[model samples]
Target: MVVLATKLYVEGDARERSLDSLRSLVDNELGELDVEFELGVRHDDFPSVTIEGEDATVARNVLREEFGEIVPDLESGETYAGTLESWDEDGIVLDAGQDKGVRISTDELGLGQGSAIQIRERYGLVQHMPLRFVYGGDGDPSRLAEEEQDRLYDWTRGDGRLNVNSATRAEVRATLNRAGHAQDYVTVERIGLLEQSVICTEDTDPPGLLASVGEYLPAELRCVVP
Candidate 1:
């Protein structure tokens, strides 16, 4: 079965109830088409949901029925953060990275290359580095792209001499050499090396592979951005 997820934007408060009803209808109707839901949509709420199915046509019908008027069609990938190259003045043109963070800017942000844009450290794995920026809808940082939820299962660690999963530390200089990230992720190893007191999310820290991401795992197994 193919897994699918979407973050949709509804109209307004007056339509909230109607939107929810629509969500229910879509969910039920799509089920007949063999579509499974991971999350559902909401009105006045840009809710994100993931679904799985064998037929693309059925998925499209449900999408169009519920959101065709407002969003027209459900777009692919996260509308939020990650996988971006650079940003200009008005908006971001999109980077080569895998994620295209939700467009949070109001004034277009130009999507220009000349604009120096930095990744917003919004979504993080428990005590781990942020995976993406938390974007507000239409100017509000409300919903987290459904794709971010997928990354929650990711326990991959950063560069440096020590690994979080193994509970071992090595000389900072030595770790950087083996890391795929920049020197910045390397220099901070000392701090996260011993931060095992709290877990921001569930235990996804796969054993071995150096920074297995266990030390930072929160009890709930969610993302820890701060």
Candidate 2:
């Protein structure tokens, strides 16, 4: 069994949809390997898959490479994927499943993103956005992965949108409708359980949409500006 570091924290119908999405993602990545697996969610909401049949080890490695392995310790030179849990002037804290939390200082953000808040705003680094990181040992500096940097760069290039957490796709859509802003966005893309990216229409300002409909959604919403 391999427990992935990412989380699935939605409830009700959203929970079912998220589980189905996860199963499809894993299956598409591992189906060719002839592995039989059972997927489940733990109490803490982390996704886990137990594999059986021939070539199970190969299947496990495939999953680990696609998602990240949950670990209790951080070692120098080790790479990890974690949720962006919180941030302050000092740095950002990643919920990497550590006893405390993994800390990434402002200076380590690199790529000319400036302070922590600036980095978050510049990249649309919404809370619970899964990000890859490399850890450096004591007195050494850790950094975000190049792939992560590239992904953020891509988000900043197109029609910017709002990324939201702690709400279902239906709820978000309904909130937009209720707020009389249904025509402001193009679509809502579900990236994880309780997480979505609202693609804005050409005339819609992502930040304006966020401000107008945010109060009704009851979730944390951040805009990605192009």
Candidate 3:
């Protein structure tokens, strides 16, 4: 069984829809393989997949590559994926499937900012968004992964974006289409199963787009103004 790094924190009908969507996504990823799988959510909200059959090994790897995995142990100097849990003046805490949350200090963040909250705002990082970090065990300091920093930095170099959490890609797309702003965004990039980034067109304003669709989303929305 491979536990997915992303979270399914929504409740009731939303949770069911998200699960169904995830099931379809998993099928799309592993349908070609000769494997049978079952999906379940852990107590921590991470989804797990149990696979069996001739291509189970390949399917497991495919799932791990596609949706990062939550492992049982952390080794020194190794990179791992974790969901953004909380942040403060000190740093950000990531739920890395451990008894205690992993904390990456602000200085180690290397994003060049004021406080951890300020950094999160600038990068448009939503709660529960999956982030990659390098583990520094044995009293060493952990830091955000270089590739992850690059990706967040690249967000500022673009046409601007509105990052959102607690909504699926399909739901975000539908909200934009229903709000008559379908042409405003370049695309909705999936940051995680429920976290999405709406890339604005050159002519669109990130905050304006957020204002137009915020009421319809029922989720947290933050804009990255370039």
Candidate 4:
């Protein structure tokens, strides 16, 4: 398995509105390229990215162009990370790490499904240290796992009320564990005669979301009314 660092340094408002979409696209395309690209920023706020693949150099080149198009002034480089495994068209699957998987989209990439990446940069491009994430390989099994993970986290307490009718009790507990059960992630209260207390948290917004629970769990997974 190869993991490459891919960065985006653009002059647009991507850092604000398009960061998530851009990062997600990078993750997905890297998978198509048979590699793993991790998006991030350096301490100096330069846009930087890391990638891994058997055809490491080719993957780096593709991302360099892709990042450049996002931010024309992109500068790219690479430092070989050790190899892990190799697979066919689907590529190798990582255990649990930033390079585990990537996201792909035509609207996001703006080039096509699996557009050729063109930009590159190990660091010195964005405005902050690299901050990004991904979950699994490709195909049905990986997609199901990622989808379930999302559903669990979507359940939350908020809007001056708590809810969770569609969510199973087990799902609620899973989100707590995924977020580390930190105080900031969940707020609890005794309700009527229910055995379990209601849980609530504020949306941390972008960047440090992993640190904050969030303004509310996603609306679809409300705590009170279904």
Candidate 5:
């Protein structure tokens, strides 16, 4: 069994749809190998799959490559996907299913020039955002991937938008409607199982939209400015 780093935190019909989507995605990825598998979401929302049949080993490798692997423990010089759980004067804490939270020091951020809180604000690093990080033993060395950094940077250069975490696409859309801000965004893009990017209209302000509809949606909403 291999657990995927992606999460599915949506409930009700959205949760079912997300699960079905994951099931289909797994089937499509592993079907070519003729492997039998069972896919399900864990209590914490992480997806896991159990492979059977002769090609199980090969299938497992493919899944690991496509979806980041979830390990039982942290290892030095290894990369893992974790969710941003919280932040403090020390730094940011990532939850990767370990008994203790993994800490990413401010120096390791590599964002150049700023405290952890300032860096997070400049990059809109909302809680529960999925991030890829490499752990280096003592001296507290850990770093986010260059690709992840580039992606976050791009968001800052894009048109006014709101990136959301811990909600499904449908829920986000519904929240916008309920808050009377449905016309503010052009569309909702699903970045991960529970992560979404709300593309704001040309005249809409990302931060304003977040402030208006944020309370209605039980998720983290951050502004993206061009």
Candidate 6:
């Protein structure tokens, strides 16, 4: 069984829809492989895939590569994926499937000035958004992965963006279209299963777009102004 790094925190009808979407997504990723699989959510909300067949090994690797895996142990200096669990003036915590959350100090964030919360806002990081980090065991300080930092930095260099949580990529796209702002956005990038980033057009205002569609999406929205 391989636990997925992404999360599924929605409840009720939305949960069912998200699960259905996940099933479809899993099929899309492993349908070609000769493996039988079952999907289940852990007590902490991370989805796990159990596969068995002649191609199970390959299937496991495919799932791990596609949706980062949550391992049982952390190796010093190794990179792993975790979901944004909380943030504070001191630092940010990532739920890395361990008894204690992984903490990355504000200074180690290396995302420029301000508090951890400020950094989160600046990067438009939504709660439960999957992030990569390099583990520094034995009293060493952990920090965000370079690739992850680069990705967030690229968001600020683009034509602005509205980052959202608790909504699927398809749901976000439909909401934008329904609100008559289809032309305002370049695309809805899927940050995680439920976290999405709406890349705006050159003239579109991220905050304005968020206000227009915020009421429609029963989700958290944050704007990244360039």
Question: Which parts of model 1 have CA positions greater than 4 angstroms off?
Answer: 1-20, 40-44, 69-226
Most TM-score-accurate candidate: 3
Residue 144 lDDT (model 1): 35
Where does the lowest 10-residue lDDT sum fall in candidate 4? 119-128
Candidate 5, run of 10 with poorest lDDT: 136-145
Error of 5 at 117 (Å): 2.4
Candidates ranked by lDDT: 3, 6, 2, 5, 1, 4
Q: Rate the local accuracy (lDDT) of all candidates.
A: 0.33, 0.80, 0.94, 0.32, 0.80, 0.93
Q: List the residue pairs that clash in candidate 3.
A: none
Model 3 clash count equals 0
Which regions of candidate 5 deviate over 4 angstroms?
A: 8-18, 24-33, 43-45, 53-58, 138-140, 174-187
For candidate 2, what is the lDDT? 0.80
Q: Clashes in model 6: which pairs?
A: none
Task: Identify the leading candidate in terms of lDDT.
Answer: 3
lDDT of 2 by residue, 1-226 (tens): 9888768887887778778878887888888997899999877677899999798999999888877777768889888888888999768888777767678888877646578988788767778767788887787877887777777788788788899887756767778888887788888876554677888888989889988887777678889888
- What are the RMSDs of all candidates, in order? 16.9, 3.2, 0.7, 18.6, 3.2, 0.9
Taking all chains together, each candidate's TM-score versus the true structure is 0.21, 0.80, 0.98, 0.24, 0.79, 0.98
Candidate 6 lDDT score relative to the true structure: 0.93
Give me the displacement of residue 116 in model 2, in angstroms.
0.8
All candidates in order of TM-score, best leading:
3, 6, 2, 5, 4, 1
* Regions more than 4 Å wrong, model 6: none
lDDT by residue for model 3 (38-146), tens:
9999999999999999999999999889889999999999999999999999899999999999999999898996999999999999999999999989999999999
How many collisions between residues are there in candidate 4?
53
